[model samples]
Target: MLLPSLYFEEGFKVIGNMVNTAFGKFNLTGKTALITGAAGLLGQQHASALLEIGATVVLTDISAEALGAACTALSCESTASRILTRVMDVSRAESITTVAEEFSDRRIDILVNNAAIDPKVNGDAGIQETSRLENFPLVQWELQLAVGLTGAFLCSQVFGSAMASDGRGGVILNIASDLSVFSPDQRLYRKEGLPADLQPVKPVTYSVIKAGLVGLTRYLATYWAEQGVRANALSPGGVFNGQGDEFVTRLTSLIPLGRMAKADEYQSVVQFLCTDASAYLNGQNIVMDGGRSVW
Candidate 1:
């Protein structure tokens, strides 16, 4: 090791090439990204991040009006040339297939499975009794799974297949939650003076659906490894979205960072996974929870 002064001087040019290539990994100049649940809060952020990096974004949601509004809003931040809006229900295989067919000539370089039903809990004294597990509606459970879990599966199958068949590998970013790796502390949602059985509690379905996405990520990562497809999951912590002050205080206390996540905090990681920066990353569940899951 001590005899490398000449080697170091001679290798400077080679090292420069590596440095340039490393930074260049994050450039997404010619890729196309398809985001599910693109009408929602997080979906818009995903679209913005990808578009900022020069990727063409396809925003897909079940509602035409909401999707249009999201696309319209994004137009202000990014040019209309960078975005396309489509109404596709992930719950229906046919709908996903149809959307894929429409994009048959194009390869989806990135897919963000970001749709999920995150039901809210009333922080008031008289909490809604329906939030309790004993009274949780079976219909709601089915609906949550269909859209969150099944939807991701179908999207992966359809668009993921397109990526595979095109001989151009793609990135599948599954949006999971911190709860995917841990159980919800019911105490966080509990309200004072409410009857024991009536206090609002986090539903079982939310955790189940999120955890299922991790499994899907692993499956897809391995299943399409040979075809240049990389699948990964992002388990994010609670985001500060104007939640009740009481709920925010309780949730923050649980996090070691003493705060919730900012909405745009995850966009960089989104860029990493969708580009060559994470080319070697696959079958990994990256947790970005402000150290909440650890605590």
Candidate 2:
């Protein structure tokens, strides 16, 4: 015999509530995520990932014009309410502090440290010579570290401290590079007839900064574990931006997948790392290098 009408209604409601709760673990509704360098290519993708999962995003960059353009690009009728933009120079403590204070009334549940100086190497003889490790300028090295490494530290210190004390906990994701785990294959950047002294090499600071981020990830992971905050690093491989076919072929040959990642390929992984979907994942560097690092 069938259950009474009231009993069936109650049972169906209970099952629906349970389903919602289970799926809600991946939902980030009402949470706010602040992304540094949000005007850059990967930064925009990271913001999109969080927005797709229902988090309000604060897009910050050093250039107000670029930040405004990025904000406008991401804004739509549906997502307009969820997007905010701020000008933040991650290298300066005061800039970070100012933004932190501006949003003091709201809780920031996630922080994506995606700022870095990635100097592109081209066939230009002058650029190639200056990029040589021996000739690399002191000023360039310092500036790179200030943005890539020290910036992550300062953001974590200010925003992460707040996350720890707020009692709600949070996520801090450091956007590192596959170079963090492996040295750059300098051969991929060698020009056909470049002299030994003129061959372009990836700057030493890139590897150092990326590696440092992973170290910071481990420190913060445990530093705030008791406080409920989690920290992790994402080590992404090269994306397929328009580059010389020769360079692309050389780079892809090293990868087991034989192809570079699309610009948007990392979005789902970003969502996972920044949401409850990765609740048990902390102190880890998740490398997405298309098997190149392993090979």
Query: Top lDDT: which candidate number?
Result: 2
**TM-score of candidate 1 versus the correct structure, residues matched by position:** 0.92
lDDT of residue 144 for candidate 2: 96
> What tens digits encode model 1's per-residue C-alpha lDDT throughout 105-170?
877889999988888877455435777788889999999999999999999988888888868788
**At residue 259, what lDDT does model 2 achieve?**
96
Clash pairs, candidate 2, are none
CA lDDT, candidate 2, residue 35: 97
TM-scores for all candidates: the values are 0.92, 0.92
Worst 10 residues of 1 by lDDT: 122-131
Predicted candidate 2 versus true structure: per-residue lDDT over 83-200, tens digit per residue: 9999999999999999999999999999999999998987467644878889999999999999999999999999999999978899999999999999988998898777888888
Cα displacement (Å) at residue 50, model 1: 0.5
Q: What shift in Å separates residue 231 of candidate 1 from its native position after superposition?
A: 0.3
Tell how far residue 107 is off in model 1, in angstroms: 1.5
Backbone clash tally (model 2): 0
